[model samples]
Each structure stands twice: as structure tokens, then as C-alpha cells.
Target chain A: MGQVVVVTSGKGGVGKTTTTANVGLALGMFGQRVCLIDTDIGLRNLDLALGLDERVVYDLIDVCSGVCRLQQALLRDKHIETVYLLPAAQTKAKTDITPEQMRTLLEQLKPSFDFILLDSPAGIEQGFQNAIAGADWAIVVTNPEPAAVRDADRVIGLLHGAGLTDVRLILNRLRTQRLDARSTGNGTAGLGEIEEVVDQLAVDLLGVVPEDERVVDSNLQKEPLVLHQQDRAGQAYREIARRMLGESIPLMELTPPKPFWRRLGLRFGHHARVERK
Target chain B: MGHRDPSLTRKWGQGGKRRAMAYLPSHIRVKGSRDGLTFYFDGNVAMEVWLAELQQLLQREHHLFQGPAVPVRICFGRVPLGTEEAAIRACFASHPNLIVHRVEASSTSITSRTGEKERTAPTLLWGPVRSGAEIQSDGALIVAGDVHSGARLVAKGTILVFGILRGMACAGSDGDIEAIIAAWELACPVVEIASRRKSFEKLSAGPTLVRLEGEELVTAPARHLKRGQGGREQPWAKWWS
Candidate 1:
């Protein structure tokens, strides 16, 4: 009976998929027999994130439809041998699989591995419902924006409605410099604003990921930054994984430079910090 | 966007190759069998070392490494893995290019050892929790009566109280921070989501929705209520003789 954890968000573009890809990869590196199931249906992207898009011969829809066995549908990532991926169908819609069916799929997967992570689709509709059906727990991923937090709040409400309360929050794209009450001109809020949101929402904070362009570049390059080992965002994701594993790893201390840095910023300063062992 | 064969190009050049190559401390155990490579790390080891080892191995065999994303299964034996490990795995999966996944100690241990065992199935809990009843678990906790000040209601999954919750209530203990404590009137029902506390006061007013915002708890208008308006004033305040 392995735990089934769903990584979800109510709004799109807040890094739900990115969080799923990074966290799953980091967990696999930590020696957990891990399987990632993308439940975004037609808008599937987990495979691409892991550089396995070209190799997905069978998909989640295929497994649900009995077109292929769950194991057959799972595409093995070339990098980490133990981790497996079951991608959502590119052609299917949200209603293709019922919650019961998803639950059955997860039940079958539980005994074979230690963890099954579902990459839930955005919004509180059928897709989200199906994604959460079989999950024993959930990881709610949100950005620091007010809109994102509100949406996360809504998602938490829905989870409550569903009688599924084991949901955690991952604050993605946090801009640390904004937290310095001393700073005044940034678009994103600082730690104080984030704390207000967290206090208002009443959920446990799993981790905070900073806004890193390297994540974008790695996505473009078909490599997760977490695999880079030396990337800051990658390290943050790694630290998050360690913290999740009960290792009491301290939060990373890399605060983004204030606007002054923007005026006189060096190109490799951020990169140099990440490279330190 | 063209799909290149990714087969032996300057994936990172020779320097990138060097960085990716090499043994990641050799302390972490990677068992390669006919099925695939299984990584085994002690329950006490830091997750960072295992991740570094995986990356180093992946970089070393950037070309030949083919199976599934590495299934790094931790053999914790009887030791229970907490929510942090699960959170880390979810974060790892969020990465754009990584294929790592997660699992924990056997299912029996997690369910019996930590989550379900915290609070026993209370057949009958009498009276309002005055100070410390510390009720918590994955199952339902039915309080026969109302809860008073300083009392705590913590549950791994759900917490349903038949009476008024005048005291503290924390639903979804463990990592399930999504739990909610609904009552006839949320009058200053000090509520905490996971470890974060929402409003300690009963709004002293009306219905409230307490949930996880980021790292703390928040209480606001339910869906039916309009936004930006200060929540209904504590009706009890005016009535206080």
C-alpha cells in the first residue's frame, strides 16, 4: 500500500507540472521506487519534462481504456532507471476516465512501488476530481501571486468538499528579495505577503521555490534543472525533497538581488552561487 | 519545435560531461538487476547525497541509461517516512527534465505506526474540550459535546464535531493540511491546518473558511460571501452584557 500523492493547482501556469517533474525526479534520486502519472489528459506534458515524449508508447488513457496494461503504458525515463511514467493521453478529454477507474489504477500501482504521484490538471472540474480520486494525499502547488493563492485556497476548499484533507502546499516561484521589508519596488510580494496568505489559508508549507530562468531554459532543453545538481532552483527542489523526507534541511538562503542589482547586475552572479558545493 | 535524437551531441560538451560523470560518493547503493537499477539508501542518510549520486550516474551513462526514471526505493524497514519525503518527491516531479519518483516505508507501517495510531477510535468523548484533549487521527473524532478554550482537535484526515467548537481545532494533521473543521457557527474556533494556525478567535462573528495559504492558516468568507468586505462583526460582541 504505497502512498498516492497528487500534485495539483487550481490555476494554470503556476508551475504545477514543473513542480511535479522536479519533485518526482528528486524523490527518485533519493532512492524511492517512484511512478508519476500525468492526469492532465489531452494537455499532457510530464513526459516532455522528463525528456520521454518520444518514447511514450502507451499512455494513461491507454491503461484506463484497457488498450494497454498499466505497466505497458508506463514510459521509462532514460536517466533514472527505477522511476516510471504513465503519461496522459494527448487525444483524450477530462471525462474519459472515471474517478473509480483512476482509483483502481492507483490501487494496482500501490503494491508494486513505494509512491505514486499524480500530476493533476488545473481547475476544480472533472479533471481535478479524477486526479484526486485515488490519491492518499495531495501537494497543492501555488505561486506567490494573490490570484494564485486565492485559487489555491479554492482548491483546498474543494479538497475538503471531497473529504480529502491530506493536502499540503508548495509555494512556487517565491521572490525572496521581496520579503525584505526594506525593498519597495518589486512586482512580487515578499515573505510577509506569503505568510499572510499561508496564515489565511491554514495549510502546512512544504517548500518555497524561487523564480529561476534556468528552470525555463532546462524545460526548453528537455532536462529538469533538478538533475543539473548545480542549479539553484534545482538545489531548492532537492532541498525540498530532503525536507519532505524528514531530514530537517534548512531553507536555501539565496535571496534575489534588489533592483540595484538589476541596474548593475553581473551575468554569472546567480550561476556562481549555485555552482558552489 | 524540432525533436532531435538527443543521441550523443554536445549535451553539455566535455566539461558538462565531466560534471555529470563520476561516482556520487559511492556510499549510496545502486543495485542493477535484470529489471532495472534500484537505488538503496539508508533511512538515516540525507536525500541530497542520493540525488547527487543519481545525477552523477545519469551524467556518466547519459547515453546508455535507459529503463525508466531511476526508481530510488528507500528501504526504511520499519521506520516511517514523513510528509516531507512525499513533498520532496512531488517537488522533484515538478522539475522540467527529471524523471525521479517516490515511495516510502511499507504501507502497513505508515498507516498503523503514525497516521492512524495517533488518536484511538473514540467511542464517546464527553463535554467541551477545556484545555487539552489533543484528539487527532485519520479516522473521524466525534465529540459528544462542545469544545472549550485551549482544547485541541487534530486529525490526520478529518475532524467532525457534533457540538460547537469554541476551542482550537486542527483538521488534517500530519501532511494533510487540506482538512476543514465545519461547525454550526465558527465563532472563534481557533483552527490550525496541518501545523499552521488560522484565526484563533471565533470571528466571534459568523461562518469562516480556514485553509492553507502558503505556510500559514487563513480564514475568510466562504464562497457564498462576497470579497473585500470585512467579515461580519462578532455578533456576540454587541450582546456581551
Candidate 2:
């Protein structure tokens, strides 16, 4: 049997689909058979991200409703032989498939695949409920903003309540620019540090993806970011994939800026130091 | 002895249609545990028949108890008790060997006095409480982790957090001002006790306690209470205790 993981964020536009693509592809690079299931029924984007939009003749709904076999709905990546893509139907709403159907589908695929990642929709409605119905684990993606962290917290609570207690956090789109602690001036606490987000959610930190323009460009280029070498976000996803497979990998350190750059309040040549495992 | 779903009885007894009431076991039952003795009354049976059955059972089994009068509770499974609980209590008053502790309509109904006094066990939560998430208890609540901002914790008695509290904590929600809300560090933006509210923008220097004093919420350092000492003046030895 294989492990099924769901990538979800309560708020929209928080890189859930992007994380699913990168992490799923990264696991494929490690010689594991990975399947990416897009559960965002009405607003499908995983197919576009994986360059399989044109090949999605049969979707998740077709497979669940017995219109097509599971293998017929799955499209193999032309380049990466280890990974597969299960696209969502753009015309159908999330309620078209019940949670029992989703769970049954995952059960049939668990024996053939090594890992299944469900790309959950933006809200905690029927779409989110169906996505997590069969998931064995959950990856909560969030940004450094308060709203994102708050949404992540609510998702974490919902996950625990639903019995998906094996959850981890992935802090995404973090700016490398470090802010001075004294600048928060107000009496309220500022969620500037990644540790604060981890502490607030009380979840284990899986990996942190830094803010990089290339990540957005990869979607347009129809390429997974992990295939792009030397990109900070790509390296973070690769590291997350390694940690998922029971590897003891420490977090990449956020290097401090030069004294001259710090004094000038400029970010120049700041990179996270990572020792390859 | 088995726990019966309260809804199975209420819909049939209250609505008076009783299409499904025939399936309910038509007998008076009794269960005894560390909590107390509970006399179970069926919703389908007539109240007079239930009383007679219970009296007959007690009369036959009174020899089993050689001690003083035993405190027992009366429970109505499916009946929607509007104002007849007193009549049931008055009928039970003639049983000299039994002391009536309470009469409960349902075990899970918050409106019942039984839920307020006995059913409310301090709920212990594992991880941090998130924003927009809520945890409510009829009596007391204790969080083993931090409570993030925008999260709400409500309890009828005391509210204690083993970790930091940066959210809202309301204790003694029914205007019992003595109920206190404590935390390892309190930086809550909103805190309420007995309908009174206060806001804390910054965390105190040490572990803190919040309680209502003379219509105003007051904060004080709680170093004396100490952690691992059961978190209160006297250690709560058991979960039920």
C-alpha cells in the first residue's frame, strides 16, 4: 500500500497547485512512482501546470463514475516516467463526486503507486472535505502574511478534527529580506519569523520555499521547478521530497546579509546555505 | 446499561407521532458506576408504568444494599420534559431507601442541570488552537498547547492553557466571577470572565492569571501556582475528580 498526502490551503492563491506539482515531481526524481490528483474540480490548474492539459480526455469524475478506467484517466509525463497526472474536470463542480467515491478511488490506486498527492481546492467546503477523505497525510502551504498563517491555522484545526493528525507545514513565498524586530513598533506581535508561524500552527516544519520569480515562470514554461537546477525554491521542494521519504535532513539556513548591505538596508547576494544530503 | 441516543426518544415522544417508538426497549433499567447510579426510563413507556417497574425492582433488590440510602439519578431517554420532571421527582420522593440526586432529560443536552454538574469534564486538547477555531466546554477547559490569536476558548468554570495564550479566553461564561483563566504567558487581545472583557496587547513578564475582581478583570503573576502541580491550588487527582 502507498501513502496518500493532500496539499491544501484554506485561502486561495497560496501555491497549493504549484506545491503539488513540484513536490510530486521531485518525488518522482527519487525513483518513486508518484501520482498527482487535482481535486480542484471546477477551477482546474494542475493539468496546465503539468503540461497535460491537452491530454486530459478523461478526468477524475470519469474515473470515479465508471465512465473510464483509472488508468485511462491518468496521463503519464513524457519526460519523467515515474510520475503520473490525474486531471480535474473544469466543467464539473466538486459536489459531483462524494467523499466515499474519492476514498474508493484512492484505495484502488494505493497498491500500484508509491505516493498520491491530492491538490485540494481553496476553501474548507465540499471540495476540501472530499479531497481529504482518503488522505493519510496533509501538507499545509502558507505564506508569511497574517491572513495566510491564520488560514493555515484553521486548516490545521480542521485536519486534526477530521482525524488527519499527521500534518506538516510548508512555508512558501518567504522573502529573503530580513526585517528588524524593533520596526514592528506597535504593541501587537508581528509574524515576521518562520519560527513564529511554525509555533502558531504547532506543526512540524517540512521545508521552506523562498520567494523566487523563476517559480512563477516555471508554470508558464510548463516545467516543474524541481527540474530547474540551482533555483532556491526548486532546492527547497527537493529537500521536502527527501524528508518525506524518511530522510534526516536539517532545514536550510537563512544566511545573513553583509554588514555594508545591512547598514544600507539593501538585500544583495543573500542565499540560504544548504548542505546537500 | 448501554448508552441510548437521546434523539431516538425525543422525536417520537415530543412529536407524539411515535412511529419508531415501538422499537425502543420497553423496560426500566439501572446502571451504577463511579459517577453515580442512574435509573433509565424509556420514552415509549408510560410514566406511571416506569415508576411502578422501578419500585418493584428496588423492592426485590433492597436486600443487596445493607448500607444507608444510596444517591441515585433519574434519566428520561426520549421524553421532551417541559414541566413534568417535578412530578416524576415528587413520585420518587416516597422511596425512602433512595435519595434523588438529579433528574436528567438527556445526558448530552446542555440545557439540563445534569450536563452542567456531572457531564462537564475538563476537555484536554493536544495541539495549539488556531485562529477562527473555537473550543467550548460546559464546565472547564484545558489546552495543552498555545492558543493563537482569533481563536476562542469558552468554559463555564476555569480555562487553563499549558502553553501561551495569544487569543481569547472566556471563563465562568454564566457570570461566575470566581472562574479564572490562566496561561504560561498571556498576551491575549481579548479575555472575558463572567460577561466582563479585557484586552492584553503584550505578554506579561511571567506566567499570568486573569480573573474578574469587583466588575473589572485583573491580571496577576501566577508563579505561585507553578506548572506540573496540576495547575491549580490543589492538584486535580483524577480526570473525573
Candidate 3:
């Protein structure tokens, strides 16, 4: 059976859906049959984020309610042939989907896909429970802020209580430049701040995505960043995908802040000018 | 070939079962009843050696007394159970003691002993504790994670939680009155420490600590307690309730 991975974060807006989109795309690029299920129900965004909003004819609710077949609801990604999107019903509330229903749907989808990625809704409500019902593993998305970490810890505790211990942490939106600058200001608090989280949660550090404009740019373009070959953030997503597939991709070397002119060249998409500069 | 002795005839025909071989030191005394077994060891016997002798004696007559129906009680003058709880429990779960049903302690310091002296370093388990996860630790119980709602944690000593405690936590289960259960969040009201439970309606939020006071498990505020002052001075240090 395929592995069911639920992307969850107790605190909202910590990149749960974004991680689902990118990781799903990255896995698909790695030649895995990936099906991304948006379990947010009423507040669906995975289809939009993956640029498959218009292509969604049937949704998870349709399949769960027996109105449509599983094959009819899966929206195959135009770019990645192996990737499919199962959108949530924007008209139904979180309670519209029960945990048992989700579990049944996941079991049905298990044979057809290599990975089932559930984009869990924010909060620990029915939607979150539904998303995690049949998940073999979970990826808890948390930012660098203490509030985010605390909520992530709560989610970790809940998942652990649920007997889901294969949880990994994906530290998102960590502005290393800011952390470095803060470290330079004070003598010791620089790395200590980041290391404390890893120590407390006691989980594998899956991957870190630098707080870069490319992430937002790719999102605005309605394309997963991992699809962009040149974006550094996209490269981070690709590395996480590779690691998930049991590949040992070396951590990408950070691109040091370029000179003002070089940054301008990079911003303008002129690689030759930046090289010469 | 003369199987004429009443005791020998009784053993040969009655499944070869023998009576529980009792051990009584000359200087001290012991008493047995349907409820429990009590040993009054003189304060003179060193705890370790006396316990070792007691276990060796039990091992010698293994087949006769296999499983006892009543709890075994080891009474002492000022001298406590010779071994630390871990060692004592191992000895008790040995051959003879297994036949005995439950183990009971009625010493004057049974409460204090159960908390500090008897309790060994708890076997800390860190993982998703699912339902039917049976963890019986003689020492203090430290679940470095949350206990699922249906999971049960039965510890002879204290139950310390570095995470949420939604499961049932039975602390002081081995008759330790001083064993306190401290959890980051105590929502489980069905907690029983030494046979005392507070309903879920009575459970409070935030950091909580529950202990047995006067044969009752009372929920109290848990503080970032320092070591060695005992539970008295740190009483009500910080109230999460």
C-alpha cells in the first residue's frame, strides 16, 4: 500500500497547504505516483495553489458521498504526469467529511498511488482529524516563531497520542539572514535559538526553506516552486522530495547575498550579467 | 515405598501442591491471613541480605506455593523492605510470590517509602502510546510524550508527564501514599492514585499535580519544583488549578 502523508499544523498560515503542493509536485517529479488530497473541505486551496482549480470536475466529497467514482475525481496535473489533485468540496463544511469516510477513501486510493498527500486544514478540528485518519506518517509544518513551534508541539503531542510517531518537522519561512544578523548583534543567541526547537521536538529535521521571495513568486504564478528549476526555494523542495524517496541529496549551499548590482541582475533574470558582475 | 505419612500422602495425591513455606526470623515475627502476608523483620537485618534470603527461601519451595490468591505484605519494625522497589518487585514476581495474588504494604512509612525509597528511576518511554499499551513500571513513570485517551499508565511510584496526559495514570499503585502525578495538562479525571480518583468534571487545566493525601488523590497546582525539599515545602508553589 502507498504511504499516506498528512501535512498538518495546528496554527494556521504556517504553510501546510503550500508544503502539500510543493512536496506533492517534488515527489511526482521523482517519478512517484502522487495523489494530493485537499482535506480542508469548505476552504479548499490545494487545487488553486497547484493551478488545477478550473480542471477540478469532481472532489473528495463526491467520492466519499458516492456521487462520483475515485477515478472521476482525481485531477491529473498538466505538468507532472504522475501527480493528481483531489480537491475538497468548497461548499461543504469540515464536518461534511467524517474520519471513517476519509479512511475508506484513503484505502481505496492506496492501491493506485505511490504516495497520498493530504493537505490538512488548519486547526485540530474535524478536518484535521479526517486528514490524519489513515495517514501512515505526518509532516508537521512549523515556522521559526515560538508560537508556531508551540502549536507544532501540540500537534506533535496529538499525533503521538494518536499513535503516529513517524512525524517529521519541516521548518518553513526561517529567514536565515535575519537569524544571522540577530546572532551577530548578540554573541550567542544566533544558532541557539534554532537548535532549541530541534532539541525540544526531538524529530528528524526534514528540510529548511529559506524565507525567499521565490516562494511567494511561485505561489503567485500558481505553480509549485519545485517545478521552477532555477529557484533556490524550489531546490529546497526538491531536496526534501529526494530525501523522502530515500535519496541522500546534499544540503544545498546557501547563495550568499550578492552585491547590489548582482542582486539586480538576479532579480531581472539575467544570469550572464550577474556572472560578469 | 512407605507413603504412610499424612503430609506425604496429601502431596502425592493432591497434585503435589505444597503449603506456602513461611519465613520467620527468630528475632522478628510474621502473620498470614486471607487478606495478605506480613513479615516483621527486626531493624537489625540489613535490607539487601534479608531480602535475598527471603527470595532464596521462596525459590527453594517453588512448586508447592505457586500462586497466592491474597496480597503479600512484608511488615518491618523500623527496617523497611530490604530491597529497592525494582529488586523487591523482581523478587516478588519470582517463583513463590507469583502464586500469591496482590502485594500489600502496611508499614508506617509505606507512603514515604513508596515515593522516595522504593521508587527507582522510572523507565521513560517516548513514543505514540496506543490503546492496549500496557506499561507496568515498578519505578516512577515518565511518558516523555502524551498518553492517548484510552491508553493506561500504571506506575508503582509517581507519574511525571512532560506532555499532555489524557490517559489514565495510576500512581502510587503499589501503596505509595507520597507518589504524586504531575502532568503538563491533566484532563483525565478518572485518575486513581492508591485507589482514589477525581472525576473528569473536577479536572482543571494548565500544569497540574495530583497526590494522595489521607487516602485520597487530590489535584493541586504543580510548580517547577526543585529537588530535595520533599513534597511539603513545595506545596502549592504554583497553582495551575
Candidate 4:
């Protein structure tokens, strides 16, 4: 039986759909059969993110409502042979499929796939509940901002309440330069630090994706970042995939390089020289 | 007008006044005593009608009772006043001399005098209250775990959380402004008491207490409340001591 994982974030625009796409793609690249299911229903964007919008003929609602067979609704990715896309229904509401139906659909797909990734809709409503109904693990995506952290905490709590205790946190869109500046007291804005976020959320760290403009470029180009091979965010997603596969990959250093003078002072073992009067 | 008219006095006898009183609404009852005058009203009556009757009575006897502003005790027999309390105070706006010594519900008074505290057992929740989960309590509420964002806890009395609070908490839901909300760590966007709400951008780490102080909602470190400030014993701490 394949493991089902739901990528969810209580707050919107926190990279949930992107994470689902990249992680599933990375798993497929590793010779595992992966199926990416978009449970956003009325607000379907996974197909667009995957550059497979033109190929979608049937969706999750079609499969669940018996309008089409499961294989008929599954859209195979052209770029990645093992990866598949189960697009959500744009015209149907989230209530179109009940939780029981969602569970049955996942069970039917479990035997054929190695990993099932569900891109959950934002919010703890029926859509969210339905997405995680058959999930064996949950990945809560969040930014370092207070609002996103709070929402992530809420999602984590909900995941636990749903009896899916194996939860992990993915800190996305981290601005390394800004975080370094703030820690050095050179920045005025008080964004929550990674440590603070991890403490507040009380979830294991899956990985941190730095603020990379390439993510937007890839989205605009209708390509999954993980397929770019050279993108930093794509590398981070690959590392997360490795970690999920039980490999102990060390987290990449997120702090930006120090100024020349500070680097020289540290090289010469004169730490006090870098301090301002 | 002061000259004695025996025939008119005979026609308007004490029994005649008592007989006429039957036609009046039961809510509007006034009693005179050596101490002062007391006004009692059944809380079920519409506020507009109650206030109108009081205004008319005051205006009709303004001359007779003009010597000094007598203290008046207005009692609402079972009315909670709640958010509508402001309207009651507005009724006495014109009569500045009619000192409102106390405004209380008769039911509360009876319970207090008899030493029988009204018990509203809190609803105890053992797990985290997730987003979109709304829990309402008729009395107090006790949550053994975190209250997540988008989640809501509404209680008629107090709300006590053993874990972090990152959601909305509404205490004193029934208009008891003294009700408080305390949590292990408060990072909520909003905390409300009897319709009064305070939005917080960031909260200090650790346990916190939120209550209505004067007209505003004040948040403070829970430890400070336990130590008692300015040599005044904290009522909340008294339970532990």
C-alpha cells in the first residue's frame, strides 16, 4: 500500500500547491510512482501549476461521482513518466465529494502508486477535512511571518485532531538576507525567526525553501521547480523529498555570506573587532 | 392648588388609587420608604416602555419631589441588562438628581443573600481546538490543549486554557464583564468580553490573562496577577492561597 500525504496550510499563498507539485515530482523522479491530487475543487490550480491544464479532461469529482473511471480521470505527466495529475473540478464546490468518497478514492489508487500527494485547499472547512481523510502523513507549509506561522500552527493542531499525528513543517519563502539582517540588528522588521516558528508550531522540520525568484519564473513558465535541476528552491524540495524517504540530508545553510570586513575579522580570530562602538 | 377640597379628596380616596393601580403594567412598580424611593421593574418589559413610564412618572411629580434629588435604587427583577445596559443609564440622563445608588437584578440579589452561588460547570475539552472548530459554553470553559487560529471559544463566564491560545476567545458571553480569559500562551488576534473586543498584533511569551479593566480590555502577564500588585490581594490568587 502506498503512503498518502496531504500538503495543507490554513493560510493561503503559503506555497502549498507548489510544494505538493515539487515534492510529488521529486518522488516520481526517484523511480517511485506518484499521483498528485488537487482537492481544492472550485479553485483548481494544480493542473495549471503542473503545465498540464490543456490535457485535463476529467477530474477528482468525475472519478468520485462515478462519471468517469479512476484511470480516465488520471492525467499522466508528459515530462515525468511516473508522475500523474488528478486535477480538481473547477465548476464543482468542495462539498461535491464527501469524506467517505475521498477515502474510497485514495484506497483504490493506493495499490498502484508509490506515493499519493493531496494538495489541500486553504481553510479548515469541508475541503480540508476531505483532503486529509485518507492521508497517512501531513506536511503543513508555512512562511516565517506571524500570520502564516499562526495559521500553520492551526493546521498542525487540526491534523493532530484528525488523528494524523505524523506531521512535519515546511518553512517556505524564507528570505535569508532579511533574516540575517534582522538577527544582526540591522533590520527593523521583526519577522518570526525559524526557531520561534518551530517552537510555536511544535512540529518536526521537513525543510526550508529560501526566497527564490526562480520559483515565480518557473510558475510563469508552467514548469515544476524540481525539474529545473539548478534552482535553489528546487534543490530544497529535492532535499525534503530525500528526508521524507528517510535519508538524513543536512539542511542547507540559509544565512547569506557576511561582509568582507566581518569575514576577515572572523578569519583572523578577532571577533571583537567586528563589534561597533 | 394646595387649598383643601374635601369633596375632591373623598372622590380620590386611597382605595380609589389602589383600584386604579390595577390598570397599570406590573413592570412599573414604585415604593416609598423613609430611606428614599425604589423603582422595580420586571425585566421582561420592553426597555422603551419601561423608560417611557419612568420618564412620565418623574415629569408628573417633578414639582412634588423637587426639594432634593432623592437616591433611587432601580431593580430589574431577572433582566441581565447585557449590552442594553447603556440604554438604562440613558433613561436617567435628564434626572441628574435621581442618584442611581445601585442597579442590580433581583435574582442575583436573592442568590447572593442566600449564599447560594450559581454554579455553571465548565465544559472541559481534552484536545486541541482546531481551526474552524467553534466551541460554545453556557458557563465557564476549560481547554486542556491549544486553541488554534480560526477556532473560537465562547463562554458565558470565564475561559481557562492550559495550552497556547492562537484563536479567538470570548468570555463574559452573558454580560458579566468581570469574566476573564487566561491561557498558557496568548497569541490570538482577538479576545472579547461581553461584546468588547481587543485585537492583539503580538503577545509576549508565556501565560497571560485578559480581562476588562475599566472600559478597555487589558492583558497582563499571569504571574503578575498571582503576586498581587500594590499590596492588594488578587482575587484570582485567593483560590490558590
Each candidate's DockQ score against the native complex?
0.01, 0.46, 0.04, 0.23
Error of 2 at A242 (Å): 1.1
Worst 10 residues of 4 chain B by lDDT: B108-117
- Please list the C-alpha lDDT of all candidates, in the order they appear: 0.66, 0.78, 0.73, 0.80
What is the full ranking by lDDT, best candidate first? 4, 2, 3, 1
Ranking by DockQ: 2, 4, 3, 1
- For B1-241, candidate 2 gives per-residue lDDT tens digits of 1233344445533665462333332355565644446666665556676666555555445554335677887766665475557666666566665678877665321222223245457888877888788888887799998898789999987898989898889898887666788899887888999999987767686688887667998787776443313233222212222
TM-score of each candidate structure, all chains considered together: 0.51, 0.67, 0.58, 0.65
Whole-model lDDT, model 4: 0.80
Residue lDDT tens for model 1, B71-156? 44433324535653664455445333434443545322121112323444533465444333466555445576655444577766
Docking class of 1: incorrect
lDDT of 1 at A169: 83
TM-score for predicted model 3 compared with the true structure = 0.58
The list of candidate 4 runs beyond 4 A from truth reads: A65-68, A90-95, A124-126, A157-161, A184-192, A257-266, A270-272, B1-131, B136-150, B161-166, B172-179, B183-241
Cα deviation at A235, candidate 4, in Å, is 1.5
lDDT by residue for model 4 (A1-277), tens: 8999999999999999999999999998888899999999999999988999999999999999899999999999978999999999999999889999999999999999989999999998999999999999999999989789878877787788789999999999999777767764442333458777776677799999989998898899999889988788998999999998889998876665578997776777675444554
Q: What's the true lDDT of residue B101 in model 3?
A: 40
TM-score leaderboard ranking? 2, 4, 3, 1
Best candidate according to DockQ? 2
Residue B185 lDDT, candidate 4, scale 0-100: 93
DockQ of 3: 0.04
On DockQ, the stronger of 1 and 2 is 2
RMSD of 2: 14.8
